[model samples]
Target chain A: MGKKTNLVGEIIQDPKVKPLSPHLQVYRPQITSVLSITHRMTGVVLSVGSLGLASWIIAGAFGEQVFSVAQLIISYWISQLLLFAWTLCLFYHLLNGIRHLFWDAGKGLEISQVTWSGWFVVSSACVLNIIFWLIAYGFFAKLV
Target chain B: MAREGVSHWWYQRLTAVALAPLTLWFVWSTIQLMGVDLAGFRAWLSGPVNLVLSTLFVCTLFYHMKLGIQVIIEDYVHDHVLNSLGLIATNIVSVVFCVLTVVSIFVIVFGS
Candidate 1:
């Protein structure tokens, strides 16, 4: 019993054993929490997606042959799908990020405003992605 | 430590503000570039305004990326040594990519 008590004491004294703030699992997801986490997730996605952007520029640097190959690769269906998703992530990140800036500026702290803005961000992102891609593929491609 | 934290937050927001418009411009430009040949694309970027804005966008982007990833690493990585290593790696990756992008753009714009 004494040893068990000492073990408990040791565990209590451990810095890492301190109680953590309730994490994601502890809370039912709400729009605020959901959008907050999505912001971070999409930020990470954009970081990775920048690789495609980097590759395109690098290919351009290497001259016509490399640039053509890069263009061909990007034209593939799989690449198009990834590009579409990347743009979605981009628009979401952009709009939500602006919301964050407004919050930082001490506006939109009300829960209703937060929820409304969250929905707006999500919807706008989708619409913008579709419109952006349609014009790129449909309208601009034809002009080219 | 407090000052450093504030500076990090400040720069993150600063870059975000810069990126908002730059992103829109980039998206518009990408749409305009659609189905253009390499020469045509190169010629577009070769424009002085496009060159400057694209360079600024690339630089701001990777710096922001590094800062954001550092925050994630700080949040998730518990080990002191590992967290530092993660930050260093993030910095290295961001710098390398940023340099590669800027240099590539210069080459595309100016190279024969």
Candidate 2:
């Protein structure tokens, strides 16, 4: 019993043992929570995506041979899929960014407004991605 | 350093404000590059205004990006030593990357 008491005491003393705020998995997902997490995630995605942008510019500086080589690699089906995902991330981040601006200016705090904007951001991003790729493969490639 | 947190937040928003329209131009131009070859891309970026705006955009972009991700690292990483290391790494990587990007843009726009 004495050893058990000491063990419990040690556990209680551990800083890592403290109760944490409820994390995402513990709660049923709602629009507010879902969008909040997505915002963080997409921010990370864009950070990595910026590297892709950098590579393109760097390729340009290296002249046609290097640029065309990089372009060829990006022309693969998997690369196109990744590019589409990056495009979705970009549009989502942009709209969500505006949503945040609306927040900073002190509008859209109401639950209804938040929900509406959340849906708007998601739908707009999807629609824009479709339209973008259509133009990409169609007008850009003159294939459609 | 008590004010450091708020300042990071402030600059994040400030850069976002600058980036909004800049991003629009960037996205539009990238779309316009769909069929553009290396020479064509060089010609497009060679314009004085394009070079200037792109330089501004790249700088502001990575600056805002570093600040934003710094918070994520701070929040999620519980180990004290690891958190600081993450931040330092993020800062170094972003600076190096932004420099490379800016240099490349400038070289293409001018040296060509």
Model 1 TM-score, 2 decimals: 0.89
The 10 consecutive residues of candidate 2 chain B with the worst lDDT sum are B27-36
lDDT of 1 by residue, B1-112 (tens): 4568989999999999999999999999988887677899888998999999999999999999999999999998999999999999999999999999999999888888
Q: For each prediction, how big is the interface RMSD?
A: 0.9, 1.1
lDDT of 1: 0.91
Note the residue pairs that clash in candidate 1.
none
Q: Residues A1-144, candidate 1: write the lDDT tens digits.
A: 333336446523455567678775889889999998899999999999897789888989888899999989989999999999999999999999999999999999998999999999999999999889889778666878
The TM-scores that each candidate's chain B achieves against the reference are 0.93, 0.94
Tens-place lDDT per residue, model 2, B30-94, is 78888578778878988888888999999999998999899899899999999989999999989
| True-vs-predicted CA distance for residue B84, candidate 1, Å | 1.9
DockQ score of each predicted structure, in the order shown = 0.75, 0.73
Docking class of 2: medium
